[model samples]
Target: MTRSYDEWKAAAAAMEFDGRPVIGGVRVAARSGETIAKTNPATGEVVSQIHACGQEDVDAAVAAARAAYEAGEWSRAGAGFRRERLLAFAGLIEEHADELALFDSLDMGKPVREAAAIDAPGSAALYRFYGEAIEKAEDLIPVTPPGSTALVTREALGVVAVIVAWNYPLEIATWKLAPALAAGNSVVVKPPVEASHSTLLLAELAIRAGIPAGVLNVVTGRGSAVGRSLALHEDVDMLAFTGSTEVAKQLQQYAGQSNMKRLALEAGGKSSNLIFADCDDLRLAAQKAAFGSFYNQGEVCSANSRIFVERSVYPEFLELYAEAARAYAPGDPLDPETGIGALVSEAHADTVWATIERARRDGTIAAGGTRPEINGSRAFIEPTIVTDVPADHEVHTREIFGPVAVVAPFDSEDEAVARANETPYGLAASLWTGSLARAHRVSQRLVAGTVSVNTVDALGFTTPFGGFKQSGFGRDLSVHALENYTDYKTTWMQWG
Candidate 1:
């Protein structure tokens, strides 16, 4: 149930937040005794002081994760044991769903309604999905030559470090944590300094759910500090990251420079949404286009920021799309009725506004391109749509990571696919069409990890989620996600 604005305000007023780093299963002050103020983007108020972890803090978290792994309390536990505990963790998350939702909503200015209804429940569902998958996993016994036997098994990698973006704090963290923990790997999580409250709360809940002490630790700080340290730490066995493409490259280089630890990265994306003239439901398509480009204020990695409409329907679709986009006007994140919330920070809003200004010079603003002050904070940007964007314009090629989309007309299906594939990112794509053959043909040719026939950014726990090219490799969901945390082992015996 969605709470009233006043109720949400009262809850925020009553809530007390602690942003200290969680090391060895307990909240601890940073050794450096330094902290960064976490400002609420919605209200321009300081929410709490988050720890600024340095190298020493990263070392301590890694040591604790390693100790937990070597202790074999969680690492050596049976699949059933892990499954049961993970289920309990999932239950705990559901029990505290409101608190988790509030944490992300307050920390990062996500709409409380969406954060409560989508992210929190979705996070719990991921835990449950991965927990159920644990017991279903089966070892392989390959055929062997006479007098010989071979057994293949999957084993957990020790001390995995997870770094997630601030956009979808608890959800993204859970995407990595559920599989890593279910696979029996002790983990150290590095949440973005912009939004670490929810992650800290998640770790506390993990402990309460009977997870082994030190099994899951959260280090909250700037990415350059805690994040980079985790990437370079020699003790870390594996690292999973969700962030910018440039950061992914840096993490890869850091891994090479240090321990050469295993890395699974889900990086940046400028996904495309192609609307063919044959689409039967233009109005529905336009609504989805708005949602694709504006959901989560377009802070999503796979947001369809590039829209290619068929020339025949371009004018009509553009108008409908603009009308749809206007529905996402930014408002108080705490208000359940608000569809759009503030950006992650004033700094991020400035960056987006700069992009909008550039887009106005090079492209036509079809929908929204304004930032209105809310609660004395100008961190709220309207859902913006830009049309007539030059093919080579910066807004057309670069990722703004905001509720801004660029629209253009394509003459043919081939042209649409070609232009869409021209991007450096291959994370996701969406194409609206009525012909089954064209759908299959175009979907096959799209240079994206996931292609949606009539939807945008289609994903589920049952399907693998990842990307190609600079969007980085390694899957995030489905049974394939387990591969991120586990390594295969083989045992052979021969008697002659």
Candidate 2:
């Protein structure tokens, strides 16, 4: 059953941690005893206090991960044992799905239903999928002439530092941790300070599921401190991050300056949604595009923020799209029925409003460019759609990271393809066309990592997800993600 906003808020306030951060099977406070407040975006209230991790805390977390990796506690464990433990973890997540969903909603301002149905379920599926993959993964195979042989093996990269973004905190963490753990790497998770409660709670759940201490560690602090320290830590063997493109660049620089650790980043996107003249279902296309760009208050990195419509259907498409946008109601995240929740915080919401105002000063506002009213003193922006934005406008090129989309008109297939690939980011794109040949051609020309031919933002667990160019390199889900956390070793031997 879904709880009311007041009930959810009350439950969150009543929830409490044991007054210490979980590290190496022990609950201990930071030596400095500082704490960071976790705020509820829906109400602008402090939901909980997380450890204010510093350089020393980061060092301790890294040491714990290093020790676990060096001892072969996670990496050297047999595939069957790892699989069993991971499956158990997945089950635990499912068992506590309600609490986890509530925590995520309260902490991150994502809709409760989505947190329960999509984010949490997707995370659990990742663990279960990786667990199964580990069981079937093959060991070293010999290849050579009859007299000589070579062995190819995969080894875990020790001490992975997983830095997750505030949006989809728990889901992103699982995307990095599940595969890394399954592939035998210890992980030190640095969750965004804005939404660290769910991640910290997940770490506790890991302990309950029998995961060894130090195999997983949670450090909460601002990116400049804890996050920067982890990126530059010498003991960290790999860095898996999902955030903005600018931060990813900084992380790359830090890694280069440090131990040159392996870097896997899934960064920002100015994803496009194309509606061809031949599309038979204009309403469906409009609905999908609306949700793709506006869902999660448009906080998704892979949001379809750019919409290109064929000139023939442009007029009709705009009408339908506007209706769909109006249907999305922005309200408190704790309201399970709310379609659109608050932005992550007041500062973020102000930035989004400022971006809209800037866009208006530079161009014309086609649709919503205002804030919505809510009972709580938190950040909440309406679903906005802008037209007449030039191709070079900041709104078109930059990642607004809000429920704001820009619509542009295209004369032909070639023009649509060109406009779609014009942005600096190439993370994901969607095409709406009835012709199979056009779909194939346009998808090939569009320079994104994931393309949905008839849909928008339809990413699956088995498929690899990442981006090209400035969107950052390295895949995030499936076997590809596992390979990113491990290094391949080849051995050649000759006998008399």
Candidate 3:
């Protein structure tokens, strides 16, 4: 709120961005000497040339991470020491919040207002939460036979490789990095090609906050090169990734082909929001439905892109939802008052527009679906709502990964649940009902990882965030996420 749109735009025009790879706690050039043009989604301008990593760069990063893990500088450090350093890292993130916010806005077209207010602060809070939680991890002593002792302790899995999606670049990275680092594991992060600025800056900040050299490294490039190398590298003990389901499956195959490295994946979703006629407030439900579907330009993994309304409320809810969806008009990312920002790239915007066009052919366009020109870039698509979609249509099952909502009507509670669970993804689902019994009943039957009653994409650091079935296994947040970066070791002693 401090900066006007003009002021923010001016700051971006004069901003100096460093897109060099960060390895072994320092800014390093790619061994391949290749680079990719980093484009600003808002203005369609080449902002910087980011170093593109090859297999050689991946090897260097892996070797450095393995060395750091085996050297006992961070992995074997005392919990209190790691905790203090992580807390300091969190503080530095807060200190440089504005700069990092600008990185997200300019790098991937995230609204600077949203990035600064939510993503940056949220990333800092995650680090702080994990920093405080690390020391609280307790070893277990189990009851054993007489004259025998057994103790189980949690230990780090060395050299964890993280590959994150472009949307919410810093926040999603933190979701994996905080718990991995908190568990005392050395990490190598491969940021999405479309948005690497914030992640590179984050790695630099980790070094500044006293994380040891080689403990955290960032390799920036296409997923085909850098991500594939990490996934197949025998030296990597684990891979934590958040991206497409297709990519997640590929990573799984690569893991099996190599060393069978552990994989923690939070993949794609075609989540649904079920609105019943008996809801306490239909208007509130419609607003939340629109927010859940269009927030972050609807690039979220757990976005409620599919909405199922009861037959009695379908007509009324669809209108309210369409009205709410149209409120999120695409605008300049640096604008403090703008709710919706540009898509990550013109290519991605085109893809989303194509999806909208298909939806129009397959169904009815309830609200916005036009690709409006913004800031001289063709990457802006207004929030769209599609209604009267068939049950077996591809639009209902596919992950659009854009600000497009599909609405359908169901007659009974059983019918609503059935339609909602018809998708291949089981990442998240939400329901709105006035009856407490109905809420619990429908929630129990929803085949999703997280079920929010009368809410959308409900999550926190205290709760585990992940999916079921093809949405990918393993949790990301909470104490469970720390476990993903670690394993348990049990020791037994017998003496008579």
Candidate 4:
């Protein structure tokens, strides 16, 4: 059953936070007296505060993670022990699901309903999935050419540093956090400073689940200070980050400059949702197109921002797309009926609206291209759709992280495929058509890491998720994701 709007509001009202950085399994403050101000975007009010950690804080977190990894309590624990504790963690998260959802909604401006319905439950599911995976994982013995036998074994990668984006705070963090821990790696999670509350709350739940101190740590602060320090720290054996393409590259450099640490990065996307005249369900496609572009206010890295319609059905689909966009008027994120919410920050909202303004000049503002009035202020943006924009426009090329969608028409499948890969991003793409062969053929040619047929932004924790080209590399889900956090070693022995 879907959660109602009033229940979402009640959850927000019941939300509580003890704002402090959880370092080495303890709630503490920054040594430098810095603090991360949590301003609620829905109302422009400072609702909470977290320790604004810097280099010293990062060092402590890393040291703690390293100590725990070396202690072998978590890293070397038996699969049964890990499985029991992880399932408990998942159960605890579910028990406090509303609290986690509330924290995420307040911190990142995500809709309360989405936080409760999607992010919170999704995080718990990932933990259970990986917990089960770890328990069933098997080592292999290779057949030898002679009397000797070779064995391959998977081992933990020691201390890992996980950096999650603000858009889907708890959910994305769990993508890394669950796998790292399941693979027997102690982890320090570096959540975006503005949205640290959910992670801080998660740490407390972890402790309650009987996860020992130092096994999982949270260091909250500005990315420039704490994030960079963790990325460059030699004590951190591996880094798993989910954010922008630019930041992922910088972390790659940081790894090389430090201990040449392992880095798994899931970055940005300007995914395309190609709709053909022969599509079986244009209505579903259009609705998903709007959802792919406007869900979470289009803060999703793999948003289907570019909608390319077959020219024969372009006008009809555009109207349908516009109609779908109109349904997502921004409201108090706490409002359950609200389809869109306040963006993560005022500056980000400015950038989003600024791009809409640019689209106003460069393209036809098909549906919405202005900010919404809420309490006589402009904290929220109306979901926007732009048509007739030139292919080379920045709004078409760059990622405008907002509730904005750009529509264009393509004459042929070849043109659609070519235009889809025009942007530097290659994270995810979707094709809507009836012909199974065309779907497979186009999917083969598309450069994105994941392609969906008759769907937009089809992502689940059961499948490996990542990007290609500038969108960064590494799979973040499924059994394959465990590879990102583990190392395989081969042993050869002579039994004869």
Winning model by lDDT? 1
lDDT (C-alpha, whole model) for all candidates? 0.93, 0.86, 0.92, 0.87
Candidate 2 lDDT, 1-496, residue by residue in tens:
6667687778766776433455775667876788877777778777677777789988888898888888887789988888888999999888877678877787878888788777887788899999989889886766687777788888898889999998998899999999999999888888888887678878888888878889999887789988999999999999999999999999999999999999999999999999998997999999999999999989999999999999989989998998899767787776777878888888899899999998888777877887875766548888888888778998888999998999989998888999999988999999999999999999999999999999998777789999999999999887888888988898888783
lDDT of 1 by residue, 264-381 (tens): 9999999999999999899999999999999999999999999999999999999999989877889999998897999999899999999999889977888898999999998999
Count of backbone clashes, every candidate in sequence: 0, 0, 0, 0
Model 3, residue 383: what's the lDDT? 92
Candidate 4 residue spans exceeding 4 A from truth: 1-14, 145-147
- Local error of candidate 4 at residue 424 (angstroms): 1.0
Can you give the lDDT of residue 91 in candidate 2?
90
lDDT of 2: 0.86
- List the RMSD of every prediction in angstroms: 0.8, 1.6, 0.9, 1.5
For candidate 3, the 10 contiguous residues with the lowest summed lDDT are 386-395
- Ranking 1 against 4 by lDDT, winner: 1
Give me the runs in candidate 1 sitting further than 4 Å from their true place: none
Cα error of candidate 2 at position 286, Å: 0.2
Candidate 2 accuracy as TM-score: 0.97
Give one digit per residue, the lDDT tens place, for model 3 in 384-410: 888877877766878988898888888
- Name the better of 1 and 2 by lDDT: 1
Better of 1 and 4 by TM-score: 1
